[model samples]
Target: MRSCSGWRRFLLCFSLLLIIFHIFSVFEFHPNSVIEIAPKKRNKKSDHLVLGPAAGQGLPNRLQCQGSKALNKSHFLTPSNASNVGDSISFVTVFTIYSTSLDSHADDKSSNLVTVGNVSYTKKERSMAILNVFINFIEVTMPQSNVIILADPESDLSLQRNKVTLYPIQGEYNRDKLMLQRIRSYIAFLNTRLKELAQNPGHTSHYIFTDSDIAVVDDLEHIFQKFPNFHLALTFRNNREQPLNSGFIAVRGTPESILRAKIFLQDVLEVYTLKYTNASRMLGDHLALAWVIKSQPNFDLRRFSKAQAFIEEIDGASVLFLPCATYNWTPPEGAGQFRGMPLDVKVVHFKGSRKRLMLESWNFFSSASDISDMLCLILMSGRTRYDF
Candidate 1:
């Protein structure tokens, strides 16, 4: 009886050992099956503005429906599909830059408006002139998006281009009320367009409104493609903390964005008209936008660094303020000042005295080649000529 009992116990022990070995073998073959791994910890000091898994990737309820689904799918919200989703991925300009230069021998002497003292252009002439230059450059560059020009009413600057649209203002604009008046006009125009675009289902939902003084020497589609999440994209001339550069403004077609822009426009009007109503005193929509950005915290604004724009490839493009010299280059503002070698300056913004001589400045600093020539000429000319 004892031998039989020992035999049964031995068999049971053997079976238990076999079960343990089988379990160990299974784990050896498939080690990760039973292991639950937690995701890596996100760094606090990371520069990237992690926009979260894009639009439709199990995002929260609010983001899922905010006209971002189309953007989520392709990650490229441009003109072709921008309208379908109520977005704007195109370029726009108000083109109301009236030259205050009183130079008789100006480079842009073909147009009376460009000459000193005769600073008035018929609406048609101004529109035609602006489009003539703008279209030439964009045509050469493929993937040319649509361009919208908002001008004064009497100056019904109408011309038909494959991608150009002109809208005339109905009200009598006070040309003397320069910056403030221009801001009001632009705000009104932008608001109207936003509403129209929102109602329509076949146009883009983003618009890059640049000043007439802005010169584009290279393709700017890359600049537009940089920031997909920002409600507004602009550069700062003076203050980086609160960038209010209205000269180059990129507005998104979202309602929340337009509302903020409206608030900013009203603020600019108040500042320029109520308190500082001096036309010559340089007030603009940029300051108003900056003020709103400072006062309000809800805006998803992106202000780029002046230096990053010139760099060929930016590492963390999410925080790109603007293309600085590349997208919006101003000569006196150190854009073409790098070792006397101008980088690939795409857009030359004629601000300050530069605005008065747009053609001269543009010709001198249109591209890296032009800038190089300019530098060579400057070196050849005596220091006294440029000093004072």
Candidate 2:
């Protein structure tokens, strides 16, 4: 009887050990393997959290995809932490190209020695070259995307890229008009398109309208994901509640957002043509948008305080606010200044003489140095040459 009891106890111990081994095997951890937990399904009504960035702060434009070895998994905002983090955000950038004149004035200066992609471009061509670099950089950084270029009837803008689509502006807006009129024309074209998109929201969910002089130095996918709930997102010139910068405005694919853009464009058009307002102030496009946003009903207006629109703000419920500096850094004062790593600068705007200097530098450097180097070079050159 004692020998039988001992054998039974031994058998039971072996079975328990086997069961424990199988349970441990299910969660087996390998030193060299990476485990990417699939995101769980979220409720649809939780869309309100998508309105703003989670505690807006200084975040980089290019976020590493999941399963990366370098970055900490906790550093990134997951679907559990944020509403739209896991959602595949979609956006289209609208670029308006009027004439290739780099500066506001028309000049007979021949093309300079500057060459990009091994193609020699004139000073006028260099203006277009700046645009070429901007577009090429955008395409390279954000692949599998859409870029719509609105070219004047007289302006011959050719972009032979897979994702880029070109549309000629039907307006007879003279290219020789003052820079403000050119801006008015551009906004008109943008508004008309926005109205069309608003009429049919099935094509895309978001749209970004920017000037040709701007270069996107970093990946913008993360930036677009920041303001998922906002119908429209604008960057401010200095502080929140101030005039907005129309150069980098983003809008959701909703009818109301598109209508507000239409109203804003109409106001700008009237200011230049019939309204007889201060052309200088209205042409900025910032004031016009502010006016529209103020007059229009509540439409989820969110503005970036510096660059990462409302990303660092603690109150996620606030629809309108400012972004950080990394969104866009320009040479002109009152535009956000840059004092960090070049890798941190998201977009570089070549304002006034900065554009000319950048065009000239392209001759020496194949492309704009990393955002920091390019910004430093522009600032240093401006200080030494123009006494800025």
- Cα lDDT, model 1, residue 116: 20
lDDT of 1 by residue, 1-388 (tens): 9999999999999999999999999889999856444122221222111122221224331112222122222132233433232233566676442443323344355443333223344433443454555654444332455677776655534356887777766543545555565676667877786677678745455667777656555555555465555555655543554455667766666665555556555665675555455532355455554554455454333433334532111121121256454466554422122222133545655454433234333334344333333323222221111100
> Model 1 clash tally?
14
Model 2, stretches more than 4 Å misplaced? 1-120, 175-205, 239-242, 271-283, 290-324, 332-344, 357-388
Candidate 1 residue 161 Cα shift, in angstroms, is 3.6
Task: Name the runs in model 1 displaced over 4 angstroms.
Answer: 1-88, 96-131, 156-160, 238-243, 284-290, 293-320, 333-344, 352-388
| Residues 207-280 of candidate 2: C-alpha lDDT, one tens digit per residue | 66676667665565565455555545556555445456656756554655555555545565554454334444
Worst lDDT window (10 residues) for model 2? 47-56
- The root-mean-square deviation over C-alpha atoms between each candidate and the true structure, in angstroms, is 24.6, 24.1
lDDT of each: 0.48, 0.48
